[model samples]
Structures are given as structure tokens and as C-alpha cells.
Target: MQKYLPLFPLNLVVYPMEALNLHIFEPRYRTLINECLDNGTTFGIPAFINGKLPGFGTEVKVTALSKKYEDGRMDIKTEGIRVFRILDFQNPMALKPYAGGLLEMLPMPEVRPFVMVGLVERVKTLYRFIDEENTFDVNKPQPYSYQIAHKIGLTLEEEYQLLKMPTEAERQGYLIQNLERIINTLQEIERTKERISMNGHFKNLDPLNF
Candidate 1:
């Protein structure tokens, strides 16, 4: 579906079903959130990475207006609904404080059991090594790969790539590859640390009795 949505560009990627809490302080954004809350509407958060705005982002809807300050600032909770590709960005609409953009909603693929299982096991190992083994729940329904992406130490660029993936299977594959690379790096670091530690330790050698 193609439609116009209020755009919030940030240096992070939000995945579907992910909950995000935002503090609206800028006058533009404050106005934007207020409009959405008042009208029961949604907004698109386009990925703003490395000083550039990406073509894709997730559409999110406000779930709660947790606080409103006397200065017109707000604390709101929102959940991502789906991914959208920006068609064109528009400056603030007439009499509006924030910007709006045309977007094409993308098709979200169904979960692939094989991919999910493989990635889940790899992530389990990763967490165990890091002593955060209980951080992720594999049995949870719709445990999409992004849920564990941050836990696996994926960089913002890597996360953006996962967000751009056309299917959950592809995302799972990406996560598995990423986790393997990170795990191998961590193991290497541990070995290096062990070697370094041994260098300063006393080697107990029996004095030769002449």
C-alpha cells in the first residue's frame, strides 16, 4: 500500500513487532507525536545511518502517551507494525511542524522453521559464551531474528542490512553468519588473553640438585 506518513529519521533501525520508547522534545517532533496521538495515526521511522537517510524504515503506531511535560515535550511508547520503503520525502506539510513522506509498504515474509532453528542455536551458543544465555527465548512465537540481533553484537550497519532483507529466512541466514563471525572473533580474543596472562605467571620449575 502506498500512502503518506509522518517521518522520523533516526540513527537506528526498528523491526516489526519491536517496542520503542521515544522522548519527543524537538518542537517539530513534539508536534508530530501530538498529531498522531490525537488522530490515532502512525508514523514511519526511516533509518538515518552515517549521516544519510535510507530508503526503508518501519512504520510504528503509538501505544501509550506515558508523559506530557508542561513545556510540550512527551514520552511515548510505540510498536513497529511493518517496513516501508520511502518513495519521496516532503518537507513539513502545510501548517505542520514535521515532515511527511510517501512510502510503499513492503511484504513481510513468514517465518521459516529451518532457518529459525539454526540461527536460534547459534545465538544460544553466543549468549552462553557471553554469560547472557537466558536473554533470548527461542520458543516464543514470532521470535524474529532481529529480536536477537542486538544481543549478538550486530553493528548498526549490519542491523540495517537485516532490516532490508526481503524475507525472514534471509534475515535468519544473515544472523547466523554474523553470530559465527563474532563468536570466532571472541574466541580468538580469549586465546590471546590467555597467552598474555601466561607470560607474566611464574613457571614453577624444580631446581636441579647438583
Candidate 2:
């Protein structure tokens, strides 16, 4: 469906089903947050990359306004609902201080078990590398790729690319590749550390067979 979305560009990526907590202090953002709260509406946060706003972003709803300071600053909780493609951007819309845009909502795929057992196991290994193995509980509700994207040490650009993927399968595939590459890099770093630690230590050497 096509509609207008209030835009909040940031340096981070927002994924559907992800919960984000934000502090509103700027005069412009204070205005934006107040309007959304007063009208019971949502906003779009696109990954602001390379000093430019990207065409893709996730639409998020303000679930709660936890605190409102006397100066009008706010602490708000939001949950991303879906990905959106910017059809047109209107900065300083009419009398409003924030930006708005014509947006096309992108449908997200239904939650399903990732069939690749290798990828699941790899994800487990990934968690182990990062000392977060306990957080990768298989029994918990699977939000799939978005659940673990941030935990695996993905760059903002990688996360942004992942957000644009329309299907769960495609996102999983992308994640699988990244996980393997990261795991290997971690393994190499560990090996290097071990080698450095063993320097100047006495070692037993086997005589070569002539």
C-alpha cells in the first residue's frame, strides 16, 4: 500500500519487528515525537548513510512515551512494523519541522523455521564466538534474521542491505554467508593470539624423519 510516512533519518538500521528506544531532545525531533504521540501515529527511520538518506527504511509505531521532560524532551519506545521504499521526500512539510515522504510499504515474509540446519548451527557458533550463546535460544519465538542481525557484528551497511531483502529466505542466505565469513575471521584472530602468546616459550619438537 502507498501512503505518506514521517521520516526520521538516523545512522543506524531499523528492522521490522525490532524494538528501538530513542531519546528525543532536538527541537525538530521533539516536535515530531509530540505530533506522533498526539495523533497516535507512526514514523519511518531510514539508515542515514554516507551523509545521505537511503531510499529504504522501516516504518515504526510509537508503542509508549515513557517519559516527558519539562523541556519537552522525551524517551520513547518504538517497534518496527515493516519496510518502506521512499517514493517522494518532502522536507519541512508545510508547517511541520520534520520530514515526510510518500512511501510504499513492503510486505514482510511470514515467520518460518530456517530449513538450513547448517546455518542454524553456524549461528550457534557465531553466538559462541561473541559469548552470547545463551541468547540464541531456539525455543523462543523466532523473529528470524532480524533477531540476530545486530548480535553478529554486522556493519551498518550490511544491516541496511539485510533490511531491504523482501523475503526471509533471501535474508537468511545473506546472513549465512556473512556468519561464515565472520566465524572464519574470528578463528584466525584466535589463532594469531595463541601464536603470540606462545612466543619465547620452550617447545618440544619432534625430530624429522630422514
The number of clashing residue pairs in each candidate reads: 0, 0
Work out the TM-score per prediction: 0.91, 0.92
Off by over 4 Å in 2: 112-115, 137-142, 206-210
Candidate 2 C-alpha lDDT tens digits along 1-210: 997977999999988878899999999989888888899988999889999887899999999999999988889999998899999999977778889899999986455545467768888887778777446554444457888888888999999999889887888899899988999999999999999999999999999999
What count of clashes does model 2 give? 0
| lDDT scores of the candidates, listed in order | 0.84, 0.85
Flag clash pairs in model 2: none
**Best candidate per lDDT, number?**
2
87 in model 2: Cα distance from truth in Å? 1.1
**What's model 1's TM-score?**
0.91
